[model samples]
Target chain A: MTLSPEQIIKLGDLAKLAVTEQEASTLAVQVDDVLKYIGRVNELETADSIGQWKDTVVNTNVWRADEVRAINEAERNELLASFPSREDDFAKTAPVFKR
Target chain B: MRANLTIEEVQNGLRAKEFSAVELTQWYQRQIKEKNPHLNAYLTLNEEALATASLVDKKISAGAKIGPLSGIPMAIKDVIVTQGIRTTAGSKILENYIPPYDATVVDKIKKQAGIILGKVNCDEFAMGSSNENSAFGPTRNSIAPDRVPGGSSGGSAVAVAADLCTYSLGTDTGGSVRQPAAFCGVVGLKPTYGRCSRYGLIAMASSFDQPGVLAKTVKDAAIVLESIAGPDRLDSSAKDKPLKKWAAEIDQDVRGMRVALPKQFLEEGLNTEVEKSVRLAAEKLTRAGAKVELVDWPLLEMALAIYYIIMPAEVSANLARFDGIRYGMTVGAEDLWSHYQQTRGQLLGPEVKRRILTGTYVLSAGYYDAYYKKADLAKKRMRQLFAQQWQKYQAVLSPTTPTTAFKIGEKTTDPMAMYLSDVYTVVANIIGAPGISVPGGTDSQKLPIGWQLMSAPWREDQMLRLAAVLEKE
Candidate 1:
């Protein structure tokens, strides 16, 4: 199944991207080819496939103890320095709502 | 110093005072200066490298024993953030972003006194198979200037192959490290997932991405892994596991070790020379007293599909941070929504955008169950299949890539074609198995072919030991 340019436009919107009509048409075909290939997963069968799904822990990584172990001064300062737009220490962003 | 020298040799040279660490660093710097313009392997050079080298030299002069990586110049993939070093991850979005702290691997390597050479180029966010997707420009194959360096670790592979550095670090989300190592004729080892901490690595598909080593020899790969692989407080995924003396363990006997050659890897689209090399490698192993057999692994074919679906799903989530709010360049648009769109659209490369969009669709409301959920189940099935294979065979061997290095721009426009390059390498990441790719031999085209080996989880010991046998010829 192919995704139309309109669907791609919708996806681009959700993804916070802006694709031109040309790119959308191209992506429509490319994305369809990928989706078609991946669709084979729907046809695959396994011995334990029936009703075996269960929610499990996401991964094996152990969580650190709950505490606020602050970063060192250099690290903190550099993180603040990387801010795209900021005043003093607070990061600045485009207004969420119109003025 | 002899060219393409291994880490051991560098250690010996320094101990014997044959060459000072400062001198060795200079040699690599000279090599980078001479070759980098043509290869585009390095995107930035560390100005403080000499200071690190001087510190190593001072330690030596004081008669203090140094670490294994002391005085060794190494390159890092740009995707791993380095404190005080410019790390762009090969995207224009992060063009001016300088990281505050080094990645866990970087910090560990620094603790071992490994001299930082510079950050190398990669496909943006480690997304593509070929280095062509790098916004900085493609890294040319060191062996053949006209050919592409298989990527997103293209610069790391090129750096090691050309002797620009003793070894380099790269990531293998899906063949980023191994493909480039194969193309450029080097050694790349992707340890079991969580073996190396992912703290400070620019996330693409968080589950699949692992920092790896690109080196001139199998043992050097082991050396790097030993230095950097361990649990970290910063990244919870890094489990507390015993770090092996990998370099020393690689010399163990391979006799009676059982190896399986997946026939699926030899099926159509595999270059004949690569197949010949793999079969010959098996024969050589047999002669070395290891058991080798051809086996049908139908499940291997389905991994690429699962990877594409799940990987893009993860990609969309990991990359949402680049919405022009916290870091990177910002576009002055009317509101936050437009700012995100304009900044990402104007900065991220086409491949990055494509994957993000595809990921958005797979995780969308209507399609989530059909694509993402199904792929998750398939991934579980693949894990079981691989676990069963490892029970009988100590390791599984395959060609690192389907073909040798292709010419520059050959697969640029074709995303699917580029994705196919990871077909053989993605299985390791999916199952969290440790993998290594050694120089199998040269194809008829004189291009290098990679002979890949995967061991059971945390079994890099047996894997590297067996790889050493193949590295003989």
Candidate 2:
């Protein structure tokens, strides 16, 4: 149940977070501690258990009329303005692939 | 001064023409200036507070009808986005992010003429049990300056307790609202999961997150809850039922109502003083005509383990949006992958990183069934168990926390120890039930202890009735 430093680094990579060697070392022990504590759940009987996807309170699907409604220009501009970097009327981002 | 007025008293004073909304806003603004420096409760202040209040005054002068929250100053946890105001969520990543729109609750409160005071501090992304995780530094408990205010709603609770605002809005993913309210000796109400719309709340654990209220009295909390709770087309998970008249039902009788005291919550590791106060509160409820009984809820013990699993899983998913491309801080790098790693690594705090990493691990390949799937099943079982108990008991009562507010830096190094602080409160969230934390009494340190009352889903009316009885006693 204990997480090793390598596993901690792997987790950080998967989570898209950078971990320094020092941080990975410290976090390895901390994550291991938490996993060991949470490991108690492993003892519970899950053989017949079915994973519940929806909340018990709001289990039904809600429907709305199929209609087209355009957002106001001002509102659309506000949303576009929230992007950190933007081209003319479009959000900009770093290059996904290099030529 | 206006700082000491309750929401009802404020409304009455406005109607009586004793003071104008502008004057009241100025008074609260002055109080924030005087107190917030030492407490660090408010991270941002609305510069237009006086203007907003004056508009309310003008409306009143025009003989326009106003809601209960008209002109009442309120603080919101930074996690709840405020249009045109910088909402940091106590993280450096979003330190400069100004939301383009108000959260659904914020929008509703504004429509009622509630004056926005400012955004209060909270743990980064509402992750930690103590406000110490705040990137801006920890908020001091108003009652005991050296102790930690239970968090991530610490600032909201402290604002209400210290009278910086008439009431404050907070979010309780676990015990963020209730625990801090207990620490600060105020009333914190966490309605059912979908009670308040989560349209613009900075998502942490999506399923467990709910907007809550921290107020000086049960009635004020009910008033705020009534204003904010209802269906919102923007939030698909929001309940479709009509909103209850909570303020109208606040004074209802609790006589002959059955309440349960789960024997598990009073076990070892619980501070003796907190245990005594909660038990005495139960006795007080009995005297107030409630039929109290001891009950066994075995599933309560598994709540913390399941929460850590499910909450982090959701956290990982929801937080993926902050991958440096959309908004917030974006550290430039050679590629998008490195951009995400560097921006999140350099910006997010350690606790947030820990949750994200652990969540990634649990939901990763080969381990999903053992951890995520199992936790989901356990959560469902816990809800079923709670429903069965509600068939007999009108509400379940326990200490809001295992102990009173701990000293600052006491549990910061030990993350597991800090996680245990929410043990008594998280079960309600897992079961998607309504819970309230009311001040029971003080511990030996004179730090306040809260007694919590949880009821079935959408049963906030009965839950508040029991809390009102306790408030009276």
Candidate 3:
């Protein structure tokens, strides 16, 4: 269950997160610990149990009534104002990957 | 004025000219202003409440049909998005953020003519068991100021218990609503998953998060529930259960009601006073003509473990939207990635960051099947056990929390200790069923303890009926 720094970095990237070196190191250790603790679940004898688990029964993707409206520019800006960075009235701007 | 009158009583009062909407709203506002300083229950006060009260008054004067909750003042949890009002979710990241749209419950609450008193405080991103995690500061228990008002819905529960507002809104995922309600000596209901819309309400665990209500009494709890429960198209997972005719069913006797008590719940960690109060409440119900039986559910023990895994996994995903780039307090940095990391690391509290990290670890690809999937399987096992129990018992009984409200910093440093507070509350969320926490009695410190009553899916009406029957005493 031991984890490496590179694996932690890969997971962080895929999850759209930016992790610090300290966090990555700490998480790698804790991840190893938690994995060792819960490892027993994999050996449970319920492999052949039917109807033991289920996907949620609920359905989805129903459309709604059509409507168009305008929001006040000032009010909208108030919401956008809390963000740390923006450019040209849009959220900006670092590439997801090193090019 | 009837100090403890229910929502229905208040409506009848308005009809009989006993009190005006303006007067009621003003009374509540005064209560908030006078009492909230000690409780720290409110984050914002509604300036337009009086204006809305005037409209309700005009309707009453013109002999128009008034909404059920017309002019009834209630507080919204700050996590719920309200149009043109700052919705902080008790985080510095959104400290001044104003949502452009109202959450579904907000729209429904407003439509019921429920006067918006203000927004109440909560845990940062609804991630903590006690109000201490809130950026605004810990909410004091209505009955005991020395202890925490249980959170992340602490303010909602305290506001109701303290009589600052007739009722208040709270979001429950893993017992945010119920545990606090228990601690503050109020009634809190976490409806069935998707029973209410998540539309404008911010996400914590999309699969488990549900907007619930807090009130001083069970009947009052039903009043808020009826106003907000229904199919909400905005939340794809929101169920289509039409709001039941609950008020009408409140009078139905629980003579033949079947109550199940899980024997495992009274285990080592449960407090003696909490167990005694819960047992007494159950005895009171049985004396009033209901059948009570001890039921065994082994899966119940694994609920907290599974909840910890599933909830944090969802937390990491749900909180991903909070990067400084789009819509919250963002700390600036030289580049985009650094900006996201710095803003979240700084803006989010310690408990929130802890979950985000833990969640990221479990949901990470290599670990997903072993941790996340295993927990999901355990969740299914618990749900099945619940379904089987419900077939035999109408509702399940347990202590809402293992203990009464702890001192503010008791478990603040240990994340696992804090997670233990939600032990009883998370089971309902895991099973996707409806549950309510009613004020049982006070502990030695005079802090309120809560007793939980759980019912099958879409069976809120039955549960409310039983709660009303018990509350009569």
Candidate 4:
């Protein structure tokens, strides 16, 4: 499972990473090792095991009542204070979406 | 055994008024001050530890009955969330990130009146086996300072072995807790998957990450495990199965219990000293009246490979939450997308970034079946080995690692070599069985080795029983 340098960079880009050409070159070798390492998973024979896919018997989730509540103003302030940009009672930042 | 006293002794001392919690906390704090400069074991030290201990002492004086773990001071792995404390997960991005709420295990331990000794170092997002990937710095092995501490729970094990604390909480994702304990000559447990809640734990490889404990003695490990185990609603994956009576069953004999040594794990790559120590432990068990057998688990060979695939794929998913949008470290940029890339690129360590990239490639649309699904199927096969063995043998045994701790930089440049450090320990996580690393003996270098004991799913009591018997011998 060899990957081209361009393919590796594409994956990194899609993953929201800023990889240098040098780092990409190193990753090509490391990723190849990872691919080769995980290939050993193909050696197992798990034809008869079904319980591995069914962990639902372990625990069941129950519903809880929803209630409007106040956020801890002090804690929220502390959180906002750590941000590099802030305004008013919220963290200030660029718009999340652009058209 | 001043450095290896059990939790029971510490509790008894506090109950008898022999020493106040404040005194005990100070003792541990001083020990950390003296030892940690060399080991790099701790990420933060709680300034309020003694004050908290004073409160516990006042409660004890007033005859207010406390939990079994009351007044015991311990460190927490940086990966677990600690409200109002910096929980970095050994990443530069989260170096100043203080979680707003305690993780479920933290809440439980705090309820038992345990004193917080602050957070210990670990691999970034629990990505690496050795502590070299920590953004803070690598944790040196307590036994041999020149060697690496098995990680990403290396700091917790070092703290326990060096007597910096009574016990520490560690998160084991693919043997982060157990392997380090093995290397540091302490006890570590990776409880049955879902035995401990994962809520508020900075997520990393969600399916395999288990919050476990490290302690100087097997009994102390059980005491901590008891406090944190049991189902919790906060973590949806937590199991509803009854918590094992670990402390209660510690004294039970392992006589007549069928134990098997998986030949597949014992042969070839294992170090000669580790093999000798494990076999000697097996002989001790046999002398204690248990039947020891050699068993074959060929599928165990695929565990490390499957783990690397499933773990990083999940790492990519779990760490995706840190994209500088809502919380933690954020680097400002002209656009939201740039904000994410710039923030993560600056904040994450090299190993973490490498894993995220590998995970994305593996989980990409076209490659998911060939990589992720096949790894899942391999995990299924590993589980079958457990099912077959548990029906005959009560537990499986092997050396925890191929050797004792290696030199700090021995394999740092080679990620594959570092990944193989967890080769023996990863199988249990993949199979979702309970596994423990019991300190067996040391190599000629005086570095400690460990013998791993694994049992069927939800059978921690039996595993602990076997471990206790080994401890006695």
Top candidate when judged by TM-score against the true structure: 1
In model 4, how large is the Cα lDDT of residue B32?
82
lDDT of 3 by residue, B1-473 (tens): 55755677788889998999999888887788888898899998888899999999999999999878777888899999988778999999898787877998899878867799899999988888888989999898877788888889988988888888888899999999999999888889999997888888789998899999888778777877787877866677787766777777777888888999889888878999888888898898898798989877766777777888888889888888887666767676666677666677678776676677678878767778777878877777677677777887898889999999898788875566778788899998988899999878788878888889889989998888878766666
- The residue-level lDDT of candidate 2 at B116 comes to 93
Candidate 1: lDDT of A18? 80
At residue B196, candidate 3 shows an lDDT of 85
Candidate 4 lDDT for residue A45: 49
- By DockQ, who's the top model here? 1
Clashing residue pairs in candidate 1 are none
| Residue runs of model 2 more than 4 Å from their true location after superposition | A50-69
lDDT of 4 at B342: 81
Per-model TM-score (chain A alone): 0.77, 0.74, 0.59, 0.67
| Model 3 chain B: lowest-lDDT 10 consecutive positions | B332-341
TM-score of chain B, candidates 1 onward in order = 0.99, 0.99, 0.97, 0.98
Q: Model 1, B165-214: lDDT tens per residue? A: 99999999988899899999999999999899999999999989899999
lDDT score of residue B300 within candidate 2: 77
Docking class of 3: acceptable
> Which run of 10 residues does model 1 chain B get worst, by summed lDDT?
B323-332
Backbone clash pairs for candidate 3 read none
User: DockQ numbers for every candidate?
Assistant: 0.67, 0.55, 0.35, 0.46
Q: fnat, candidate 3?
A: 0.36
Model 2 chain A poorest ten-residue lDDT run: A50-59
lDDT per residue for candidate 4 within B1-473, as digits (tens), equals 25555789989989999889998888888888888898899989887788789989999999999888889988999999888888888987887787778899989878877899889999888877779899899998877889888899988888888888888989888999899999999899999998989997888888898998998778888888888988887776787888766897898888889998989888777898898998998998899889999876677788888999999999888888887655677777877777777888778888988789888978899988778878877676567657866899989888999989999889877888888889999988988888999999789989999989989989999999889887775
Listed in order, each prediction's TM-score against the native is 0.97, 0.96, 0.91, 0.95
TM-score of candidate 3 on Cα atoms, chains taken together: 0.91
